[model samples]
Every structure is written in C-alpha cells, then in structure tokens.
Target chain A: MPEPVEIGRLTFTEAEIRRFAGAFDPQGFHVDPEAARQSPFGGLVASGWHVVCAWMGAFVRAHPSAADSPVDHPSVIAPVGVGFGLQGLEWKAPVRAGDTLVFFTQVLEARASGSRPGWSVFHRRNSARREDGVEVMAFELRHMAPDPAPGRG
Target chain B: MPDFFYEDFVVGEVKAFGSHTITEEEIVTFAREFDPQPMHTDAAAGAKSVLGGLSASGWHSCAIMMRLICDGFLLRTAGMGSPGVTENSWLAPVRPGDVLTLRRTVLEARTSKSRPEMGLVTFKFELVKADKTVAVSQTCLIMIGRRNPGARLA
Candidate 1:
C-alpha cells in the first residue's frame, strides 16, 4: 500500500569492517588492508556477510517500535515473529569502507498459517543501498507472527 | 600461499567444517541488536509462543555458518568474492545449546568467460546440528582465482 519504509542508515569504517571480519569472516581481503589492496578488490571491502550483519543492526534500530526504546529491550509495537526462510539474496555490489548505506523493507504478503493455528506468516522484501543508490544486498525474508485479529486464534 | 585455485575444487566433493554451539546469551544479544522479536528476546514469551522455547534468528545462523566456512577453508583459499546467494532456506529452528556444523559441496565450477583470471564455483552449504538434523541449507556462487602464476587479479 505505502512505499517501503526507510529503516536506517549505516556507514562502514575500516575498523568496524575488520572487527566483524576478525570475529566471523576473516578473509584476507576482509581483514588485512594491505593484503586487500593487493587482492582483487584493490582495497579493503566489507564482506557480504558483514554487510548483511550491519544491515540487521540498522534494521532493528530503525524499526517503528524502536523509537525511544532501550537498546536491549525495545517497546513491542508488533509481536515478534519466527524467522522461516529467505529467498533471492543478491549481493549486487561490493561494500567498501567509508561507504554509507540505506536500508528498506516492504511487506509483500501476510496470510494465516495452516500448520500453526495461532500464527500468521509474512513475507517481506528487503534491500540495502549505498549513498550513491547502488544496491549492495537484497532479499525476501519469511517470518511468522501471532495473529492479531481478535478471537482468530 | 600455494595456489588452491579453481582447479582444486572438484565437483561432488563435500567438505565439513568446524562447529559452534548456540547459546542463549548470544541469541538474546543478537536479537536485541538485530531481529529483536519477542520470541527471541523474551524467554517466557518465546516459551509461550509456537517455537516452544527461545530460538536463534535465521540471520544469526547465517553468521555462524559464515564463521565456520571462514575458519574451515575460505581464509586460506584463493577466494575473490561472491556475486550473491541463489537459495537460502531455514528448514528447522536453531535453539540455544545446539552444536551446529557446516557442510559444503562443490556443485559446479566454470571459468568466467568475461574474466579470464578468475573462475566461478557454486557450492551447496548446509548447517547440521549435533543430532544430524539440518537446520539451514544454502546454495551460492563464489569467485575464485586461477592457478596460473601470472593470472593474479591484483
């Protein structure tokens, strides 16, 4: 119905990139700046995984209910749902240090779950783009939420 | 480092990686900063929900898989970068205290028609729990360098 909501914005820094890389994805091009410069990217580039992780962080912070909420426990504007699956994940472009990204998510569909009597499944399309508007990553996330309709469950 | 290039990956070869045990603390911490759904952050709420108990977010599972892959082989391989993911499915929920391991199979390998210095390798990845239950399955492509001494991209 409405245009996709703008979730949040994030800028990648070398240190942040390396910190994530060191912990989860320590590829040479991801961890060593000098080695990365000599690698195919010609400089340090955030791992696709790192970009996805940062996107999650930004998405959570910018969530509608996250306003004025504490970092650990935010106001529950909507019921938390179970993550089911993801579809069509495309890392279209490289994310380098210093590049800022904007995130967005749009609800695609929501229907009652036949297997889970009290729950509804929602499909959401999400994307992250650079300041230049080049897309870095896109995907469809499927999750299940409690049915909101009164007496429906 | 010796060239573990495009030639090294053989079709049908399945490689298993290290494992990580999911913990309740990490699940709540990650969900608090990322997914933050009640089922993930609130234990009592989660237990009352369909999941029956607290569970790890699917994205958290992806991060764990990536860690195992990096530690298993990507760190020492002649890897370029991946174009994107074609398929990613979470078949089962990952709960705290579950030990998960990653298994990868070389599904396809072909030289890049446009970039001679590199090749494309498609892999089938799965996250299997301690009881041999697969929680997540993914198929994706990676760009890898060739073995030729003068074929380095940088």
Candidate 2:
C-alpha cells in the first residue's frame, strides 16, 4: 500500500448541486433553487448517498497512497453487506448545494476470510465534515482489499 | 410497461423480488471504469491485500439497484423524480453467483401541499440474497400523479 489517503475540504456550488440533483435525484430540494428554500434545509441539498459518493471520489483523487497503490482498474473489493440494524450514520445537517464538504478516510482493518480463501476483508472508516467546521457524516466501510505481503490478507 | 400512478401506491406495502447476479466480468468492468481497486479488479490482488478475494464496488451496487427499480417498478410510472435517499444499509456481502433481490415497504404517501396535481411516495427498500439475508436497505422518495396522467411541474 502506498500511504493513507486524505481528501481535503470540498465545497459545493449551486450549479454543481443542481446538476447532480437533476440527474440522479431531481426533486424539490435539489433541482429548483427557489423550491429548496421551503424545505427543512432552507436551501438546495445533496443526497446523503450522493454526498458519500462525492466524498469517495474526492478522497481517491487526493490520496497519493490510494492513487499509487497497485489496485485493480475498476475496483478489487465490493461490499458484501451493510448492517442497517447496527449502522451509526447521522445526517446532522442537510448539505445545501452551495456549501462545501470534506472528509478523512483511513484503512481500519484487513482480515482474510477464514471460510473463503483468495478473498480478504478490508475495512475503511470515513469521517466527513461540513464547511462550517462541523463533522457531519461518518461511516465504517468494509470491503475486500488484498495484501502485498504473503500470509496476510 | 404499465404506468404506476400515485393511486397505486400504498403505505406499509412491501414488494419482495430479486435481480441479476454479480459476475466477475461485471466486477472488473465496473472497477476499471470507476473504482479501480485491487479487490474489485483482481482476485489475487484482492485476496492478498485486504479483502482476501475479489469484491464489488458499493456505487456499482447502488447503480444496479437504480436500474432494477427503474425496470421493475418505476418505468413509465406517473411520478416525478426524487430529491435523494438516506440511511442506506448494506447488510451482507454480495459475491459472484449471488442473486440479488429486493423487499421494499411504502413508508409514507401524501399529496403535495403546493403541487396539487402530484403526490410524494416514500418507501424503505431492502435488498437481499437468495438465502434471505438482508444485503442492502434504503429509503427512497418519489412523486406520483394524483389522477391525471399528464400531471407535471411547470
């Protein structure tokens, strides 16, 4: 592995928000500038899932460790499942289209599956903060990553 | 495809079903296109590094779910798009040969206070495996027609 990757602060402009919203989540709070003013957020906002996706994009782009790693082209590991019953995601505030978002992700753990060889388990933890200097979203993403050394997945 | 109008939706309703499998070819294709991680691309690389073996990307799964919903239920539905989703839950790992399925519950439905011709339908979606293990879950919001087929926002 190259090194741990860290994505700096990322802000959102109204136009980018509108574009992303219009494509995947065109709705009252995302597509229309005026319509969003009436929602609980008081302005246009991005979807939490989308926010996570965006953070992933930026994080990968900014992290030299991930960028320099000998990872697969598309991706090597896919998440097997998510524990909804045990998740600790809290959308503290709506991500308005105009505000910026930032995140910090680190490799938490890597364990080879005892039941399945040639398949290891990789875990990553992401902490997202809003532009106002507040941590807004956090998640522990577990996937499959490979080990460069022998006998260690 | 039949148009699913607003009137066809009901709160507390659940739809259980399945999707296509996640194959090695698809994992590589998606990884190469967007994720490019060792686990998602090379089985050996993934096996050696962290995940132990080949895996899929989370976004790829989300995109697959979108396609499934659009084809299985949302196509030609007399409904507007969504603002977005929240509280996505992936309960288990999906692998090759795994047949993806879904179980969705209609959580809420109400006519828009301002947009008289349209109504919003909110649902909680659960993705599962053939063995009935919950793989992924999420809450989705969609707008549907009240009565008119051509009801739209201007």
Instruction: Assess each model's interface with DockQ, reporting 2 decimals per model.
Output: 0.49, 0.14
Over 4 Å off, model 1: A66-80, A148-153, B149-154
lDDT of 2 by residue, B1-154 (tens): 3367887888888887557787888877765644655556677766653435666666656656655665567655764546546456655656667788767799988777687777888888776778988767777677676676435533
Q: Residues A80-103, candidate 2: write the lDDT tens digits.
A: 321223134455567775577777
Docking class of 2: incorrect
Candidate 2 segments whose C-alpha is farther than 4 A from its true place: A1-55, A66-153, B148-154
Fraction of the reference Cα-Cα interface contacts (below 8 Å) that each candidate reproduces: 0.66, 0.16
Question: For this target, which candidate reaches the highest lDDT against the unseen true structure?
Answer: 1
Interface root-mean-square deviation (Å) of every model: 3.6, 6.4
TM-score of chain B of 2: 0.87
Per-residue lDDT value at B142 in model 2: 71
The DockQ assigned to candidate 2 is 0.14
Residue-by-residue lDDT tens digits, candidate 1, B107-145: 998886588888899999999999999999999898888
Give the TM-score (0 to 1) of chain B in model 1. Answer: 0.93
